[model samples]
Every structure is written in structure tokens, then in C-alpha cells.
Target: MFRVLGALTGTGGPAKLDQEEQSEKILSQAHDFEVALQAMDYVLDDHPGKGLQLLEGSGAKPKNEEDQCVRVLARGVIEFLEATLGFEASVMKKAAATLSEAQQLSAKRRQQFQKMGLKTSSLYPPGTEYAVTFAEACLLHALLMLFSESMVESAKALFKLRKAYHMLREILNDINAAKKKKGSAMYAQGNNESFASFVSADSSTFKSVDIPYSLSTEEQQNKELMELAENVYNMRKKRLEGAHIGNSPAIERLRTDLGIQALKDLPKKKEAKKPVTLSKAEIDKDQATIDEFIHSGVNLCFGILQVVLSLIPPAIGAVLSVVGFHGSREEGLRLVWRSTKDRNIHGGIGLLGLLFYYDGPFQFTDVDFDVPATSDGLKKTSSNDLDNSTLLHPGKMLEDALLQARALFPNSALWLLQEARMLSSRGRLQEAVDLMDSIDVSGIEMKQVRALMIFDRAMTLVHLHEFERAAEDLLSLLDINEWSHALYTYFAGCCYLENYRMCQMGLMEYSRIDFFKERATTLIFDAPNMLSRKKFMSKNLPLDRFMLRKVEQFKKFQSQLQLQDPLDAIGVSPVHELTYFYNGYNRMTEDCLKLSHKLLTEYHNPTIDAKEPNQELVKNLLTSLTSRRLGKVQEGCDMLDKNVLPQIITLQPDGKVKYIKKTEDPWAYPTALYERALFTWKLKGLDGLEECKMWLTRAQDYADDYELSARIGMKIKAAIDRLEG
Candidate 1:
């Protein structure tokens, strides 16, 4: 009995360790677990430095595999946070290295368990928890690899993702198998154990089962998983074999058939007949923690992967299907929702993921407007209603989750940020700004979160037409982080330009007009030069690329019109023009829309050149979009058809329109098509679905290399999907 308890406790022998030492070891393990949890709590509460310090202060050497895994994972998470927030290559490299070390630790632990003759298929296998850790480390490492400037690294990341995916699937299979075998003798014995025995059992009375040790024959299975991973990797490699960098999609899909083949080809290994088993008390005590941790971790990692992969544009999604990978957004959301029900670190992250999706990407792509229900039982056409009816509405779920998170971590500013985002989405911009301002991020160690809060507030301020304040907030980001200096500079410049225009129209104080104009000119010209200084994966960020294009066009317009003042060449407020990418029009208040329309119409480059049709097209596009948001669907449609479309298309003798492509304003034609589609949908509802799809399809063709083309593509795909649904 003494031998069994000692073995279970990893002491090797009762004679080698005294009773006091045994108790101290168990207590120390518990303490380490608590410390890890506390560290995570600090991070979620926005005190990342405290979190890191707490983790590092807790003994540098881990006492056990679990402790080692927890410490490495916690530290790696901090590194990941810093890397993603700062977008620094060096930080990402460090994160990858830390996660790689975790993977190695997990592998070593797995080998130790295998040598102990533990069956991989057994419920709550001694070291199966390491598999969960391994998968998680692999997934995180793969994600960090994506930040690399090398395509080879990206390709390697894809292979790593496949391996992690399969590893997770295997763990899920083990869990399902355990559920099926719950009534077996081994399982029943573990279940029948008393909690009291677990806490108070005398080491002398415990007995070790005499199980024969044998080598595991799982090498073939590992090879099979690797082969499956290789197949998907090769498919992507073939597709991108000769493509220029950044030309082809970085990731290709794994075919569904290949996925099915993987499952079929990798048959489950036979379970060991004489598996070593811990006593019932020990099993019951440890199983609860193990189950919770493993289950939540799997759900969190797999759920995020699904959600991210599912976000691929349908055009890209279809192409991805040809190669092999597919993700269901609905299933992904469901899994993430499940993970949020736990109290673990996974649950906290799951909550953040849901909030970000509901407030950020979901808002950006979903274009449904609110429609009042009719007494006659007419169908409502709002996208929000559609999502609600389909059980995809996260409103109530998110509210409940936020409540739980706030209750658990009362000091967390992250939740407050999410709440503010909710307010902003509901058109309560000032309240959102106020809520954001109330959070004192001045002392927060995570500069990324601080930057995010500041950026969010600035954007909300822009929506409120507080241009001067918004400019100040944007410029302030430069001091906090170096993620994107060009983006900050360009946006600050646009804000100043907006302020100058407001002053010109007497909407703002006229005394600072010259100061605003001069600052705007200097910042705008300086923005293009800053681009070469910052890059992501060796390419200009999408927003930076868009800014560069806009600056070039602005200069060309100035040259053509022979304008001396750079401000005079601006036909539309560049800030307002860029807001389209953010789906800002959808969130605009009626009065704000009116103000925007007025400003867009009021600004004119005095000398109109017939040769430069882009300036007029830009004005019309902004006006038409604002008009649509203002509930003038037909008016918006007419503006696009009569005013904007005519300038970009020529009626051929065969009665087919040939697009008159302009290199300068390539974005105008496609964006106009997309706007026209939305207007059609609003006016015609279900009747106009086909027409909306046609227009959306045409928009895709015209979007090549256009500014914010990726964003436009996502909107186009989302609209088409909604129309089809």
C-alpha cells in the first residue's frame, strides 16, 4: 500500500521520502497550481507585468511535469501577448521558442508515461494530459510562426497546425471513448472513491497494482498522423509552388476528402489489457482537475481555429475547399461558447474571443439594419434578426458571459473595454467613449491593451466628429507602442484635415484653421515615408498599403489640378472615406450621417479636371453610401447608377457595358458596385436577392489591388452569404 501511494505521488519509494516530505510535496503542487491561476488572473485583469512577475517569482524550477507545463505556458502566453500587440519580429521569435520548449517537455513526459506502460486509450491516463499541453503548444507555436517574414516559415506553420489539429482530434476521441466505457470496472472503481479517502488516506495502507511493463507500439500511429499532415502540407505547397510572394493566398484549404481519409486511415491502437491503475481515491481526487483542464483547453484551441478559418472569404473558402480544410463558424462559436462556461484560463480567453468577434469582425462584415416587426407577419430583413432567428445571435449569451467574467475578475479593464464596444455598436458613442475614458490604463503593463483602448476611443471620437480630440488620441499611440507609426500618422493627419474642413465651414472654431491645415499637410506628406520603416511578414500592412495608395492618388490629383495647397486637392475627407472599410456608416447616427453628407458635398477642388474623373467619383461614392445609411435606398441607388457608374463604364455597340478602368481610383468602381448591391437589397428585400448577388459578384472582379480590397471582399462574401441564406 505504501509503495502504491508513493508511486502515484511520483516519490518512487516511501522509504526515500518521509511522511512530512510527502505532505509538503502535495501541498507544494497545490500551491503551484494556485499561483499559476493567480498569475493568469493578473493578466486578465490587465496587470500583465504583475502576472509575469508572479510567475517568475514562483520557483524557477518546476517540481513536476504539470507544474513545468503550467509555468512555460503562462510565460509563453505573456510573450505572445507582447508579440501580437507590438508586432515585433523579435518578440514573436521568443514566443515561438518558449512554446517549442513546452512541446519538448510534453513529449518527454509522454515518453515517461509510455515507459511506465500506461495505455494511451485509457480514461485519465497518467500522462495523457501532456498531449493536451502538446497540442496547445503546437497551436501557439504555429500561430507565432505566421508572424515570420519567410514563406518557408509560414509553410512550416501550416504543417504544424495540421499536426496539432490531429493531436486534438485524438484527445477528443479518447474523451469520447472514456464516456462510452464509463460503466467498466476500472472506471467504476475510480468513480466510487470517496473524497475523504483522497485527502486522509495513510500512505502505509495504499497498494500498487502489479502491472507488467511493455514498450508502446504507437510509432506507426505517429507516422500515420504525420503522413496525414504531410498530405495537406503538400497540397498547399503545390498550389503556391511558383506564385510570387503575396500574390497567392498564404493558406490553402485541406480537402474534406483528405480529412475523412485521415480519420479512416488512422485506426485506433489496441488498448493495453493490463494497464496500471491508481487507487479509487487518488483517481477521483486528480481526475476532476485533469478533466476540467484538458476539456476546456481543447475547446478553446479548437474553437479559435474554427472561428478564424471560417472567416475566410467564400471566394477563398471555395478555393480552400479544393485543397482540403474547412471550418464551420456556427460549430466554432458553439465550441467557444461551451469553453466560456468554465472558470479556467481557457474560459477567460474564450470570453474575450466572443466579445472581439461580436463587436469587431462581426460588426464590420454584417450589414443588416434594424427593421421594425409588422403586425401582418411580414418577414424582417435585418441581418441581426437573421442571425437571431438562426440561433447565431450572441446577445444574451455574451451578456451572461460578461456578467460572469466581471464577477470573477472585478478589476479587469478588458471586460470594460468590451462593454464599451457594445455601447458603441448600439450607437451610444459618447457613452462608449466615457466608459473607455473611465478605465485607467495608465498603469497597465500590457501596452497592447492600452493601445487598443486608446485606438478604440479615438475611433469612437471620430464617429462623434470630435476631430481635434481624435487626432490627439491617435498621436498619443506613438508613445505607447510601435505597432504601426504610419497608420497613426496618417490617421492623425486625416483628423486634422477634418478639423480644418470643419473650421472652414464654421462648424468649429475658426481661429485654429491655419494650424490645423499646416499640421495636416506636414503629417500627410510624412506618412508615405514612414511606410518603409514598418512592415508585417515583410509586406506593408493592409491599412498602410491603403494609405500609400490614397497619398499617391491625392498627389496625382493635386498635380493634375495645378493646386498649390495640398488641402485644396482633397475632394473628400479622407477619414470619412476610410471609414467605409470599418463599416462605420452602419453605426452612424442620423444626424452624424447628415453632417457627413454635408461635409462631403461642401468640399470641392475648385478646378475640376475632366481628365481626373477620380475626384468626382470619390465624392459621389461617399455621398451615395451616406445616403443609403440615411435610409434613402432608392436615392443612393440612383446616385450610383446615374452619377457614378456612367463615369466608369461605357455602353458598347453590342449593348454590353465595358468598364472604363482607371488606374488612379481602382477602388471606386468595385465599391460603387457593392454599395449598389446593398441599396438593392434594402429596397427589394428577398425579391432582389439574385440581383444583389450578381452585383456582389461583379464587385469582386473589379476589386483587384484596390485599396482595402480585402475588407471589401469580406463584405462582398458576407453579403452574398446573407442573400443566399
Candidate 2:
């Protein structure tokens, strides 16, 4: 009968099954599931090629639908990773095709099971597993489509994501319904037994497994068994004492041997174990195996979808909501936390997702922090307060999760990078850099992870004011990946420019100043041209576009002054202005902030007086930022309102129509507005909540069509959400 079922289900041929397993053992669908998990384990261990090889070897010619689905899904994952990391159009196309195939196969299997009225061995209804896999395929495919250059493809991706969202909701509903039914059945069964009988039965069913003696003397084995028996005897004696049962002679003797002084000293009664029949035990084992497989996959995928959708800027999120597509970051984080509880590949991915969110976007974009109460009033005394604040603090959780991941995959460099990021967030800049440097990416096949390590280390160095070394690190990334060459080049240029400023300020040797100046000019001039050559999905990235705009502004400034060097024509440090977007200034040391302030004030005063209104506006904007970070909140606010905001907006005589001022650097206006909002929130606490929102909303409105507008919008949304919450 088993052979015939195997043949009909296409799980395996009769001969193959006979050779693979004993006739008494039933074949399980979990074989392919386990294999897929092992493949992921191999990848996490820094053996990505071996992982792909194993998957291909097992899934090349799958005999069953489940095997085929796992195979195609794994293939799609590899392709998606390559495409995203390398930005290869051809690889992305292949990923799209593979995911589509997986989706169709899962759907077909689900329909076949439903039509045949088949019942799964587990508690879930027939085809439920296939339905979950189908939803996963849909979500992956939608995510891949988002990288497409075509507008139509983007629209289709949104609809597909919506479909997957609804499907996951339905699957969760089915799981809840099944759980309720099982609960009701269990409750009904418990009602049939008397309370005394139930308690006694549960106590009697607590049988311990006997360990077989191996390669040990009989005397030693006997000693171990005797120890185990004594422990069990004492446990039962304590239970009897807690239950207030009359102590028989046997119990009294056992308690006497255990050195019990008084009956009142006995521990409280433990909760009674649930009694299980042999048949029910076997059924539960099967149900639990399948439950882990299904629940982990569903929660991980759903959580990822929610988080990605929640990150969309409000401008785009509002449009998406009009079409019934919405997401909550809080809800997504909760679901991801659930998946992390399971010991599976999905759980690992969910853990990494949380780490990235907290260390990356959450740290970079979130603006809320607790202001220290000084004698005068509330004020932000140190930039370090941003990470130390109690609002949504994830430091403890991050540390615990990183420790767990390191224990599981000691050879993996990815977790080490996350550890370094945690260190950086806690203000240990040098330690973070050291930790990142110690990560050996020699065995890791994924170049993207390598690129990330370099980028992160360079950013930390920037915070440490090691500009020359940071520039070298950023330049090294050009050889690693093609995802964003323009951005890398632009970053290198900014670093060199910063080094030149240091030299001019007598912070470095004056001899290398000319070399740094020339290098900075060359890289900045070349950055724009690199963007035109390196296009992903036939479109420039948002950051790359921002870089191009800055380069254009620099060219115009240089031409107006007819200076041989572009840096000579600038009033404010472009690198410092650019760092504001990345929240780099928020991590600066007191000494670093002072040096930056001096660079802006001493060297830029002449340029500010060069009949350039935009130059003066931007100078004040950056100076205010530096001043605020150095514990001068009121001074920063006064400078912003007095010198920056008035220049950007002039009041009309009628007081009905506001005249807006035009400047070459339009991004500075909205960014200044955002800074003002932060100032209000710090000074007034909850009292100025409405005013803070007003400033943020105006910033968002004015951010339209400006450089880094999307970035500004995201920060504004995060701030507003914090206020409302």
C-alpha cells in the first residue's frame, strides 16, 4: 500500500523508496523541508556555493510538488540575491521567471489537492502548505518586480504584493481556526475525567527514559542510575508534601533520606503535566513538525512584506493607501519578533531583518531623543544622547540577538558586522572599526556583504575624523560591486574634500593640501559622468541623483568665480552638508563638532559675502547644526530663525500672500525647517507638539523636487509618528 501511494503521489518510485527507507517507516513530506533548511545553514556558514550546489543536487529533478516548489524557490532566492547585489538586469529577469514558475506550481498543487478532497496528515486542511508556499512565491516575485525600470512593472508589483498580503491574512485565519478547534476538542476530553483522577493520572504518567550503559563499568552505570532514581524520588516526595497528602511510611523514609527538616519547607506544587495517549502523542509529533515549517515561513515572509511597505515615504505611502495597500512598522516588528522565536532559516532571516532595521534605518532616520534638563530649561547637551535615549531603545535586544547569532554561526562575517554596528551606535567608534576589521570575508562568496563591511567601517572612520583613511576605504569599494559606483565615487570625493579642509585648518600637514585638493576636484568632477555610465534598471538611483545635483551646483559656483579648483569656490563644506543626510553629525565628538564649526566660520565668511544669497543661507544652516550638536540649542535656533528662515521666506506687505525666496540650494530650505522642528521639540517637550508637527509638515511640503527630498520626507514621517504615538 505504501509503495502504491508513493507511486501515485509522485513522491518516489517503489524501488527508490524501498532502498531509501525500511518498509515499516512511513515516508514524510518533511524530507524536502529539512533539505531546504540545511541548504540555508550552509549559506549562513559562509559556504554559499556549497549551499547552492546541495540544493541543485537534491532538487534538479524533483519527484513531488513540494520538492519542486522548494527547488524553484531556492533558485529564485539565489538569483534575487545576485541581481540585487550586482544590479544585473539579466539575473533579475531570471529571478522573475523562476519565482513565477514556483508560484504556478504551488497553485496547481493546491488546486489538485482541493479537487481530490485529500486530507493532510497534520491538523491543517489539505493544500494549506501549498497555499503558504504560493503566497511566499507571490511576495518574492513582487519584490523583484520593484527593481524593474518600467512603470507598468512597478504597478503590477504593487498589486501582486497586495494579493500576497491578503493571502497571508487568510492563511493566518485558517491557522487560528484550526487551533480553536483543537482547543475545543481537548477541553471536551478533559471534562470527562474527575479532578482527582486527572491529577493522579498525570502524576503516574511521568515516566523517565532509561539511558543504556555504554563502555562503562557496571558499578559506574549503577551509580548513575541510583543518582537519577534518588532525584525522582525526592521530586515525588515534594509533590506529595505540597498536596497535603498523608505521608505513608515509604514517603516518610524517602524524605528522611533527602534530609527534609519540615513539611512546610517543601516546594509549591508544580503544574500537572498534560496526559497523552500513544496515538495522540504520535499525531502531535507529526502536527508539530509541519507547524514549525508552515508558521516560520508565513511569519517571516509576512513580516518582511510589512516592514518594506512601511518604509515607503509618506508621499508614496499615501498614494499606495488610496489603492488599499498599507503597512505598519510596529505590526511588522511584532510579527518578525514572533518568527525569531523559532529555530529555523526564516527565524534567522527575521533576526537579521530586525538588526538591520534598528541599526540602520531606525538610527539614521529617527529624530526623537530625550533632552537633558539644565538650570535654564530642556536642552540637548550631547549628540550621544540620541542613541542613549529611552524612546524605543533596542540596545539590549540587539546585543542578545547578536550573541545568539554568533554562537550559532561562528564563522559567518555577517553577524560580526551587525555587532560592529551595535558598537558604533553605542559611541564606541574605534572599537566598532576594530571589530569590523577583524571580520574575515575571505571565505564569504557574497561580495555585497563585503561591500557593506567596507562602507560601514568607512562611515565609522568619518565619525572618528579619519578622513584620509575613510577616502581610501570608500575608493576600495569600487572594485567589489557594481551596485552603486557613482555613490562610492561621490563619497570618496567628499572624504578627500574633508581632508583638504583639515589641512587648511592646520589640523594636518600643509604639504599634502594641494594633493588632497586636486584629488577631491577630480573625483567630484568624475562622479557625475560615472552615474551616466552606471545605471541600474536604466535609471539613476536617488542618492546618485542627489550627488549629480550637488556636482552641478559646484560647477556653477566654480564657473561664476572662474576658479581653477571647485573647492576654492565653496562657502560651506559640501561633505559636512552631505553628512547631515546620513546623521553623521549626530555621532560627532565635541572636538570634531568644534573643528567643523571653525572650518565653516573662519574660512567661509568671505564666500558668504561674495553676493551669493544661497551660500550665506547654507553656511548659517550648517553652522546652526554644528552649534546645536555642541550644546548651544538656543544659539542654533536663533541663528536659524534670524539668518536662515528669513532669507528663504519673505513676508509680503499685505500679510496674505507669502513671497518665497529662490536659491540655488533649494534642499537647504526644507532641511533647515526640519532642524527647526527638532529645536521646538527639544525646547517645549510635549507643550510644543503641535508646533513641531507644523514645522515638520511644512518641511515635507517644501521638500518636493529638491535634492534628498525623499530622505527628508521619511525623517519627517518618523518624527510625526513619534509625536502622535
Candidate 3:
């Protein structure tokens, strides 16, 4: 009878059949649901309405707590994506509801896990961690999506974002604890007596299996688990700590659109529940991680609020240093440094935030340089000094962080791109190009990454004065990605036009000009962004207001070049006479002057030499122009005579290089002479024409075969015809 009873129970084999069945059911349901949701993503790409079909059937229904959480999270994610893409308002409302449900479900599920002793210990079951982690990640990602989709900065949005922040912090704590335990266990096993005894007893085993090189199944599983945890940490870190416009910019913009105190009166934590207690060991182990997490979170939150506060009405960016967000440059740098020093994690984003803090907003074309004269003289300052006081060097810090990030994530193209950017910023053009070239783009499946690398390389090439190479790179980028069609087309045009200028100066072959010109003409006028009907900014192609102006510049430049074809073909003169010559010239003059002023104010370091030859050249050119315009012909002539161009080497058509004689720039000396001659002819009529003629002759000599000569020649002949006829 006892034997029969043992057989009925099967000892331990069939005794826990119910529990095994339950676990298997839960796992199967959750896995199937997740896989179905992933498949639905591709379907939703083309047929977004198909998502509603998923919610209609038991195919996506939850069989257990984990499945329930996954169902809620996936539904929320799908709806949010649809809503962001301009889906129905009803869908957006449903998305909000789903996300709220997911958040509550996640919290309740955590409570259930705690009750089951899953989080504190591993007593519940084998799949407990997966359920808990998946539910938690789902909650965090949903909140992130909610915040991303939210158009207004309501008290609710801030609360959700803050909650997500705390949740991520907790997740990171658990991951760190697991990592510590794994590390300790690995260390102990490696140094254990059994391992040492085995190695000593079997020399052949030692030869066959190197102790460190060979990993048991369990050890490999642990290694994979740790890697997965690290990846989770990085994912959460990016969303929470990234500088995406969604993260802080949207919140800030919401404040601006609403008001500064729009969400200020809201409760700090939306949830009023008390926090769970942990052991002293747990607290001690996670203290550093907690501190770092909170530090970064606060900076991110209030830093955004402060920026918004300072942006209203009069630009109060200066007041931020005084009374705004308590986060200083020092604190921000410290946060980035902490992340950057850690291994197998991301801090490149934090570094970017620090850069934005220091470098200020990207102004596209609004570069302003102002210098005020003091009692002693003009006080010297620079844009570098604008933000470098509290930091050793932001550039060096960025480089160090990028290096650490690359070491940690060797396959991450982002780190490589950032390192390349840092190199380009520091004027290491060739090194930047080489670094970008070293990236194996063939294996990179993300077209955006490939496009970015190519674009960055092209920009670096531009700096290196390799216009043809730069244009080629831009073409390659456009072929792969049309993120900012206008932006790329404009850049390509700029490259080609720059090469055309070099060709005009005999530095490049005339045949090269036609190739580049064809490219520029095809791309410049019909730049895509200029005609973009899309409503939203492209994730891959970011464009600013200044880009519109750049397009205009390209148009004006191309039009001017077209007008010069007759003169260019005949080799009669360098300067082409256009009907609207003065308009283009004046407009370009203002633009050039603005650029010069910015360079002088922001980039010039007076302390280096106290006397800049380039600055002197600009001053001389300005003085000559001013005197000529003010009817002081003699003074203008004197100024023009004193100035000369920087020595330049010209590459001749015969493949030989020659040093040209020091002379004035065509725009400077020839223009000065022409202006003076015109004024003289105006004052004294035909008798004054002799001095005018002489000046014209001198201008012609200086202009030689350059484009400037044509304009001067046209004016001289017109005046001479009036005087003689």
C-alpha cells in the first residue's frame, strides 16, 4: 500500500505538477503576447489602424500578472506611436488611458512581487525576475512615451516624468546589487579550493580548459544576465538622461506656452504611498548609485525649468548664474564625470548636456560679437571664456568621456561619431576624417548612423579645404538618407561653389568646375527641405531657421555665378558685371562684415600677440571703404595703397605652383580706385577725367585677369564715353 501511494505521488516528480503547469502557462502567455506585439509594430508602420484589431481579440489577452502588464504596456506604446504620428484624437485619449493603466498595473505588480518574496529573494519561481523586470521596463518606457506625446506641461506630466525618474533609479539599484553579487560569486569560485584541487590533480584538464578562458553553463548564463541588465540600465539611462528635445525641451516649451508656475504648485511626488524598507546592507550598497541618480535627475528637471524661466521676454540667461536653477556648471560637470568614469554604461549624453550648458544654444547664423572700449583700451574677451571658467576645458572633458564611452561600447557608432565631432571641433580635421573612415559602415545597419558619419566626414573635409571630396561625401549621404534634403543639398552646393572659386583662382582645373557646378546647380535651387510638406521635424534631419538663409545665399551665389558665364568663357575679366551687382554686393558685404565681427569678437585672442595682422588688414579695408564713401578720394587712395593681400601660392595649369606677387584683394584695391575715379569725374567733369583715367588704368593692372576687372572696366568705359562723346 505504501509503495502504491509513493507511485501515485511519484515521489517528487509529479508532486508539483500544478505549479509547473501554472508557471509554464504564465511564461507561454507572456512570451506569445510580447512576440505578437513586436509583429504588430511592423504592421502598424503601414496600417496604424491595425493596432485596434490586436486589442479586439484574445490573441493579446493576458493569462497572468506578467502577461497583464505586458498587454497594458504594449497597447500604450502602440497607441502613443500612432498618436505621435498624427493619428486620431480618440486614439490619443486611449493611449493616455492605457499608459495610466500600465503605470498602476506596474505598481500593483511590484507589490504582488514583494508579497511573493520575488524581489527581496529568489524564492518564488524561475521566471519571477523576467516578469518583474519586463513589467518595470514597460512602465518606465510607457511613462517616457507619455511625456514625449504630451503637448502641454501639466502637473500630471511632471509627476509622471518624476515618477519615471525614481523608478529608473530603483531599477539601477537592483541591477547594481545583482552585479555586485555576481562579481563576488565569480571571485570566490575562481579562488575556491575545489577549483584549485581539480587544476592541481588533473594537468591535462588544466591544459584542455584554461580556468579563466572556460566558463561553465551557469557562469555563462550569469554573464549573459549581467549583460542584459547592463543593457537595460543603458536604455533607461538614455531616455532619462538624454538631451532629446522630448526630455527637457518639451517641458520647458510647455512652461513657456503656459507660464513659469504652471506646474510649480503641483505635488513633487504624485504617489502618496510610503516607500518600501530595505536592509542596511542594501542601502549601503546602493548609496553611491542612488546619489548619482538623484543628482542627475534633479539637474535635468530643474535645469530645464530654469532655462524656460530665463527664456521669457528679455533673455534672462545671465540671471541663471545668479538666482535660477541651483545646478551650477561645477555640479553639472561632476555628474557627467561620474557617469563617464563608470564602465559599461552611457554618459555621452550627460557630456552633451554639459556641452549645451557651456556652449549655449546653437544659434545657426546669429553669431554676435560685441566689444566695448574701456578707459585704458578695448577690453579683450572671447567666446571660449564665455563658459570655461568653472571647467578645466570642456573640449578635453568631452574627449575623455567619448574615449571612455568608446572603450565601454566598442560597437556603438554614436561614441565614434561624437569622438569624430570632438576632433573636428578642435581643428584636427585630418584626424577626424581618418577616424570616421576607420568605422566599418558596411556592417552598420542603421542608415542614419552611416549618413551621420558621412556628413561629419564631409564637414571635416570642408575644413581641410578638400571641397571635391566633401561634395562627394555629401552626395553619398544624400543617396542613403534624405532626412534634411535641403540641408544636404545646400552643403553640397557650398562645397561645389567653393571648389569653383578655387578653380577660378587656378588652384583646381577648369574641368573640375563644370563637374562641381553641375552638381551645385542640380542640388541648390530645388533643395528639398525648402519645399518640404512634412509637418514634423525629421529625427534624422534636423534643420534650423538659419538654413533657410543659407539656401537663400546659395541661390544668390548661383545666380551671380550664372551671370558671369559670358565673361568667364571669353577669359576677358575675373569680375562679371551683373544688372543687380550693387544689391548682391551690398548684401554680401553686410554678411561678410557680420561674420568678421563675430570672428573678431568671439574667436580672436588679443593676449596671444596683442597685434593681429588679419585684424589690421580688416581695419585698413574698412578705412579705405569709409573714406571713399565719404568723398575723401585722396585718403581712400592712401589707405588702398597701404594694404596688400596675404601671400598666396597659386597652382598653374601646367601642374606647377608659383608664389604670386603681394597685391590687394580685387574687391578692395580695384573697388577703391574705381570709387575714387568716379568721384573725381563727378566733381571736375572732363578735366577731372585724366586722374580718373589714370586710376582706372592702375585698377585694371591690379585686377589683371580676375573677375573684379570686368566690373571696373565696364564703369571706366562708360565714364570715358560720356567724357569723350
Top candidate when judged by TM-score against the true structure: 2
Off by over 4 Å in 2: 1-27, 58-61, 64-66, 78-94, 117-121, 144-156, 184-287, 361-367, 370-391, 605-611, 647-663, 705-707
> For candidate 3, what is the total of clashing residue pairs?
4
Mark the regions of model 1 whose C-alpha exceeds 4 Å error after superposition. Answer: 1-34, 58-60, 64-67, 114-127, 144-158, 183-191, 194-287, 314-323, 361-391, 607-611, 645-663, 666-670, 701-707, 721-725
Candidate 2 global CA lDDT score: 0.63
Q: Clash totals for all models, in order?
A: 8, 0, 4
TM-scores for candidates 1 onward, in order: 0.76, 0.76, 0.41
lDDT of 1 by residue, 433-539 (tens): 87777657785557777788888888888888888898899989988775578888999999999888888889889999999999899888799898777766566
Clashes of 1: 8
Per-model lDDT? 0.63, 0.63, 0.40
Write the number of the candidate with greater lDDT, choosing between 1 and 3: 1
Evaluated against the true structure, the overall lDDT of model 1 is 0.63
Q: Worst 10-residue stretch by lDDT in candidate 1?
A: 206-215
Cα lDDT tens digits for candidate 3, 450-506: 666776677556546566787788777656653445566666765665566556556
Model 2 weakest lDDT span, ten residues long: 206-215
Best by lDDT: 1
